[model samples]
Target: MSKILIIEDEAAIRRVLVKILNEENGDYIVEEAEDGLSGIEKLKKDDYDLVLCDIKMPKMDGVEVLEAVKKIKPEIPFVMISGHGDLETAVNTMKMGAYDYISKPPDLNRLLNTVRNALDKKELVQENKRLKKKVSKHFEMIGESESINLVKEMIEKVATTDARVLITGPNGTGKELVAHWLHQKSDRSKKPMIEVNCAAIPSELIESELFGHVKGAFTSAVKDRAGKFEAANGGTIFLDEIGDMSLSAQAKVLRALQENKISRVGSDKDIKVDVRVIAATNKDLQKEIEKGKFREDLYHRLAVILIKVPALNDRREDIPLLIKHFAAKVASEQGTIEKEFTDNAIKLLQEYDWTGNIRELRNVVERLIILGNKEVSEADVKLFASK
Candidate 1:
């Protein structure tokens, strides 16, 4: 059911508005306020999906009410009610965040359409917020060690800038998490963040994968397709395992970085792109450069802000917190009560070599949760958490 509030000074107009809405939809619960002040009081005390506010009222006008409501509950959609003289003011209210406006003696079709559209928009905004929260949880950095804290500080400092970041770390050490945090906290958070794993794509196709290709570019190219760089326009693109990218692809990437433009695989037309590049690799690019496997110039371009993630053994102090977090997450996913890890069990797990880092730790925790008793113990770690 949708909750709507009508703030109209005229009793007859208020009744007619309520009657029209109630007759239009049985699910609408319409509430009335005699003036703008009373409407604001109600808004403060209760939640309403939509507000139909009059432009002129005693004590407070619709513009004032709209401003106050925006400061308080900015998400609620407002549809201003205007008289003949207030048409200009009604349009102005839209610039001030009103969803829309309806003239006095409202048209049935226009009023209903605006109300439905506003509600749909509200629903979309809420869904986006929920999905963003879920994505944040999935990539949450779950440690407080000094090494982790330094990484967090760096993210805060660099996220607002359009700098290219190169993250170096061992596999499974959460380099991808750092990339996600940078994009989510940046000015381009509203735009898409495209990711490409250089090591995963075949060397023969890596160029086309990053720079797109026109139709008939290759034997298998049936249609034109946008590449990672094109898809990430006005946003961030995460290039993982960039050390494994072929030399030819590196040249194209360097050109894109230098010129902010790319030509498709089979086309000569250059396309402009505004993108923030965040690249990560487990292999040491300096060593690759020495061996002639990686370009020296490309390395310099990508490493404007370098962040090295510490190995798990170096941040062992955060293992206990990580265990608790994984335990709750696994239980939630499996629809079971979260089992506790005894102090000794946590200590034992922390002492082991985390060759695979956080990724390995999560797997071990899941195994223990499934095979161990309700409260996992040191013995359980010994029995099931072995390499």
Candidate 2:
């Protein structure tokens, strides 16, 4: 069911609009306001899915009413109803946040279709708000090492701005984790956080994946579709493994970063997007640039805030703390008492190279918990966690 408000100075026009809405469907809950001031008052008092406002009105006028309604309920869609003389004002109303403008006397079919579309858009906005809340709640950064702490501090400082962030680290070193935290903490956190793995998607499809294509744009493009940039409007996009992106895709990615616009592979028209991009790469992009595999200008665009995650081996002092954390986690998962690591066991384990970083240590901890005796000993590491 939809709740609609009709705000018109002319009593007969308001009544006619109400009748059409009621006849189109009883599922509509129709309400009326005879003037702009009264309409804004009504809007404040109740939650309406859509508002239909006439341009010429007493005291406040439709423009005033639309502006006020925007401040009050930004997501509630408004459709302007205008007389032939109100065409210019109606167009202005749309620029002032009206969902659309309809010239009066209202066409019955057009009124119903506009109402349906406005209500649908309202639902999408509501769903987007809900998803944003969920994303903000879930993407919390959990760590206490100096490196992790520095990352958190930087995120706090930079999250409110639209600067590009480039995260560099080894696999499972949680570059993705940092990217998610940046978005979740940012001003755009209330909108979608679209993520794409440059390495995972096929090279041919990467362009279509970032910028949507029209129907018949290419083979396998069975229908028109919106791309990630369009989908992430007023939001953030995390491009993971950017170093591995195809050269052709890099060109498009660079354009989007440079001009804040992108073009679908088969389309010549450029689509403008308001997206804040945070990218991650495992390889040294400078080295890739030297080898003629990466773009230098693009590197500068993405490295506005370069954060290099220290490899677990480089941060060995934090290993014992991490080991304890993982031990408790693994013990809970396995439903058994956590094995205590003797000081010797901790030292012996830390001395070995952590080629796989934090990820490998976590696996070793699981092995220790499942296979070791009452208390894990230095000998236990030798027996169960060799290399």
Candidate 3:
């Protein structure tokens, strides 16, 4: 249900707003305040999804209320109420962060549409906040080794800029983690970080997937759709396994990098996008370029800042910490007690070759947690952790 607060000095206007909102939808729980001072008091006491305030209140005005609310609860959408003479003031309120303004004797259609749009924006904002928290929790860089520290230091230096990054590493060495870290630390963290696995999509459809298509663009195209670049405007787009991208798509990607624009698969018009590109691949792009499979110019465009994540076997000292981290993570996820790996068990596990990198180690840790004894021992590692 959406909670709406109406702050108008006029009793009749407040009643009208309450009636219109309550009758428009049963889910709308409308509340009223006689003046801006009372309105702010109510706001402090309760959470509101939207606020409609009159510009000319007796004790406090809409402008003052808006400024106050911005400091305390900036997420709530504000709609200013304006009389004929207050139209200029109402317009100014928008620049001060009011969502929109409605003239006195509100038009039902305009009022309802504004309210719906504001509520939708509020929902989107809240969802973004939730996803950011989830990303921060799930993608933590859980090592303090020199190799990992170098990657961390590089991210700190480059994340503040819009420079394109190319992350090169073996499979499962946490290349994606580095991408997420770059995005989260960057100024575009509020916007989305869209991820596309270039190798996972079919070669024939990769172009359409990166640059959207209009209806009838292909046999499967039923309607016009936006692609990852469009969706990631004002944000970051992580292209994983970019080495596998087809040459046709590579040309289009290069064009976008050069001009900051892309044409839909079937459309002649180009759409301008302000997106930060971050690409990752396990394959050696220089080798791919020599083999004529990858574009050299495209590689140069994406590799403005190169970050190579070290494989797990190269940083064996972090294995014990990783095991403990994974054990606690598995216990929390599975609703069980965290298991402790014996020192000998960790040493033995560290000595083993981890060709599959961090991804394989996480799977093995989870398996041992389930199959090993209360305390994971070297014997359990030998039994359940065989390559």
Model 2, which residues run further than 4 Å from truth? 1-145, 334-337
Q: What is the C-alpha RMSD of each candidate to the true structure, in Å?
A: 7.4, 10.0, 9.5
Expressed as tens digits, the lDDT of each residue in 1-387 for candidate 3 is 999999999999988888889889999999999999999999999999999999999888999999999999989999999999999999999999999999989999999999999999999988876664444768888888999999989998898689999999999999999999889977799898999999999999999999999999999999999999999999999999999999999999999999999999999999999999999999999999999999999999999999999999889989988999999999999999999999999999999999999999999999999999999999999999987
Q: What's the lDDT of the predicted structure labeled candidate 2?
A: 0.86
Q: Could you arrange the candidates by TM-score from highest to lowest?
A: 1, 3, 2
TM-score of 1: 0.67
Q: Judge candidate 3 against the unseen true structure and give its global Cα lDDT, from 0 to 1.
A: 0.94
Q: Rank the candidates by lDDT, best first.
A: 1, 3, 2
Listed per model in order, the count of residue pairs whose N, CA or C atoms clash below 3 Å is 0, 0, 0
Model 2: which residue pairs collide? none
